[model samples]
Target: MHIMRVIVILFPLLLASSFTDACLAAEVLTLAKDGNAKAVIVLPGGATSAARETGGILADHLKQICGGEFRVIVESDLKDASVKDQRIVTKSTEPVETFILLGEGGLTKLLGATSADLGPGGILIRTFPNAIVLLGPGKTAPSDPYGTRYAVMTFMEDSLGCRFLWPGELGKVVPQRKTIKVAPINFNYTPRIRQRRIRMAMGLGERKSHGVKRLGFTDADYHYFNKAAMVTTSRDGGWANWHRLGGSLRLASGHSFGYMWEKHKDEHPEWFAVQPDGTRDQSRSPDRSRLCVSNLELIEEIARDRIESLNKSDLNSVSIGPNDGGQTSFCRCDECRKLDPPNSRKLAGGGPALTDRYIYFWNEIAKRVTEVHPDAWLTADAYSVYSAPPVLRKLHPNIAIRFVGLTYTNEEKRRQDREDWDAWSKAVKKIYFRPNVLLAGRRQGTPVIYVHKLAEDFRYLASHSLVGTDFDSCCHNWATQGLNYYVCAKLHWNPDLDVDALIDDYCQSGFGSGADAVKSYFLRLEDITNTIAEQQLKITQPFPPAVIDELRGYLDMAAAATADEPDASKRVAFLRSGLEYTDAYVAAFRIFREHEAAGGGRLLKETKQRIREALDNNWLVSRGIFENHHLAVNVATVAWGSWNYFGRYYWSDPSPEIRAKVESR
Candidate 1:
């Protein structure tokens, strides 16, 4: 895992590279004659070896830069040496005006302390005539481990005069009298591409699965691994068909995709997911089937066969999912009833009951999987009903939990979603649950709007100590989701990332050099989008009409900013595209207000007609094409509240004109 990058410097043999160099050479000659030479070098414990190596490099560079006699010492062995020895060396050392701590450890030791001894009049209290603390090229000085490192760095820099400098800044040697602006290079670059290696067992119905397999995902999609870093894949999966497509696509991609096979529910009536009301899950009926984990035999067979099959495949791990049967009524079956007599109340919801059974079953399965593939990771989707905290299982140390938070609809619901997240976060951290947050959109709907909401969620999560956050675009059809995914992944990898700068970089990388215009346009668009969001929130609050007017004034200003951009095409396109959302919100708000005024469903028919008209408008079609085809489709899929109306009124019994317009599009 070690990578070496070297920079080489060539100095002119004949001295006159620059006037500054000539003057420095003259000063060095005079200084050397005076015999006023001083050098102090310090090295840390863990990086003592590296510090010594770097010190040699620095000494060579320094000799070239200063052209004066200087002694350089590398103290690489004191990291493990006794404190008494360190004290004796410090006390016996000659007083040197110029001191350089080669690494954090060396600097710490020179200050006569360790991190644990940070008190008043401690290390921070110590001062030298001229001191240079060198942080290694890739290493960062330790900050508050319990809080956000950026916050800690900011606090320290503001409260103390301790300047943070990067390795690049150390290339030049500075005189004791000179003042240098220490600009620390922020190490927060988001990689253009990243890969995640997943090892999990997929429970497949009868068709496949000798056991679970290892898999790889990159750029928010499944890919086959040629090496540890490189992955290749074809078409991403579609809605309601992720499992089937994910398996074959994963395998075909030359990556390890795991699975566990079981008989189809139709063939195994006894193993079908059961509901609290005794009815089976019919959501996405016929396409998806559930499994009853309340049956011990079923659980055992899944755990044993799945693990075995996975071990036999190229899969790095095994993943278990959907488990829709768990959402059905809790198994009132004699066997399940007896096992949970004292805890019946705990499994109140059909979802919770099913999740409990699945978790209990998987715990056993995880044990079996570990026996064979000790290094493999297990993934269980804590999605839907199981997304809440109390229902999720306390997984084994070897198992990892992927908390898929997709059920929430809007920002308000997302705020509530955080409560569930808090519960799950506490549980996982308390039990050392290795958790990854999966912010996903519902399969078929306008939930695409949730992407904006997710940006806020990602920011909040990044502020915490979570391992990482993964954005589920579902597939390429919803490619607009890709924009959100890319942004979230970039932020997740490095929380202190400059998102606006990233947008600029993304535009340049994806488009070309002249795309700076587009970058600027989008940045302004983002600003306006945020402004509108704030306005929407303010309007929802119990503000006076005057306050509301003030908020609208702000919105008007935002609108005006984008109204006359240099790129008329981009401006018009963006504004025209946003009009549908704006119009929809206005119409929805009007209808809601009318209903309140009349104390009933006032103008319900008129409101429905306007919404239908908006959907049927060619603008919607044009917007879809401009944004990307999948964007509209994904949004429509998640627009169930509105879709129900469109489906019934527009599709089922449409008028000739409306039908013709829709068909033309």
Candidate 2:
């Protein structure tokens, strides 16, 4: 295999002295063997922050490797720079040898370009020897990024040895031409529980958890989470991060979560939700709050605006609506009552009528989105109040219903949890009536609580008829913890994957064969940690101190299991210390719980003292094991305890200073 290397070299002195820095910078980048060198075209269109930063980095790298005069053109300049034959002109007087076309698909379209355009008869005839096209980090048409990039890279390497670099570095390659396998990938609707397990097991990467929220209707916060997903997905090749038109529009414009509904209510004050005293409801932000979907015009206008804006982004898929929680209450205005005659029967305390309106409104929105972006995918979040089996209007075949299952409270509450899932599943079946539904799995409340149920749900969903699922355990709230991200990645790719085996693989990859025994001990430690952090903590009622002691003994047994390892003396010591630490913490938790249950000034003082002691002892143990174990253990301790401690103060009526102290630590 012949590989053509383009070495870009930089002259710092020339750059410093140039008056026309931007233009001169362009001219200085041309290849040394003017006529012998190939023509290179670089173009960048609408870019996300990450894409722009990456472009700048690539440009800098090129400058350093290929020092000389070079002509650089932006995507906007393509039309003006083209000749009668449609070949892009080279500013250099010398004939070009290689051509590099860089930009997103939108910019490429402007150039009247295709992958085949780099061929002999196509445009940029003189620069056919070497041509490379760069995509983007911005939200783009799904097919262009996934299909186009793969196709172009293969074509470029075959036709001209020029490689494409955008997402990141392609490491050392063997010279031999080996056969490659290509698989067809699609996003089918997966069950919610399965999605949660995969995502949780992948562990919190940068923005994975946010991806889950984005999959719901919280578009405003999607970018923050998407950044994290992009980094993690790129590193571990399970799936590529997708950019949708509707999502991109919301992100770029900084639109609020429920902006569409809010805008309508602002124009018509009569559509606002009314309170018992006849005053307009103002529970959340009045300016950008939800509106009554009673008025037909309001719904139409919102649909039109959202559809048009999304179409402009050139995206083909998007998840619609807000975070899946709260009651689906709208308004009990006269127009709403007239539109919904059934409201008369369900209007007890004016609650049912309001709830009915919200369902009607959401179903209408889904209908409109399907109409506008027919080829695009639309996911309606069947979460919170919308989980029940209400009459959903007909939808386009292309639109997929996503059932979002959130387990925040105790997992053992089968009655409530099953009812929630049954309601959502029933509603989805009523509307779509197909097994091709996707489940958006989320574990709300505390991180520890969510992770515990998430694992159990993953196994449960995997046994059912699920198309695909998205996991959201790695969010801003959970990133600080020592969750097993590698395990999560494995589950994402295949939910039936054995987590223990995955952990073993991760340990081997991170630490070589010399540390196999250490890896085995850590894997065992992880199982123990999950058992304590997830399973044991779920019991609703308080346990006796003896029960706590029994749990401590079990942890001690786990520690003892590793004592006989011949090659892991250090691991054995660390395990013993961890067991001691857990024992002390469990004892402290029992005391704190007892005091908390009793309630009062004495209990408050005792709780504070218990926390102080636990923190002090744990901090010391953490320091001692810092060099022996992975950073994950320490990070998990902080992440798991941070929210738990803080929530105790807010939810359990602890002193204000308790939260402050935990936050500071």
Give candidate 2's TM-score.
0.46
TM-scores for all candidates? Answer: 0.47, 0.46
| Predicted candidate 1 versus true structure: per-residue lDDT over 1-665, tens digit per residue | 00000000011121132123322332111112123445445554454443455455444333433454445564552233223422323343465444445434644455443334221111221122244343322222221111111222221222112111101121111222111112111111111112222222122222111100101112222111112111112111111111111111121121011111123445556765555567654344443445555666666776676577676877666665544332233345555543332332243344223445546655777787788778666666555545555443466655555555533223444455567566656654311111222223232221122334445665565444344333343322222233444454434333445555455444433333334544444444344434434444422222234533443343344345445433333323332333333333234344445556777543467766764564444234433432332222223222322334345334323346855664576
**C-alpha-based local distance difference test score of model 2:** 0.37
529: Cα error in model 2, Å? 11
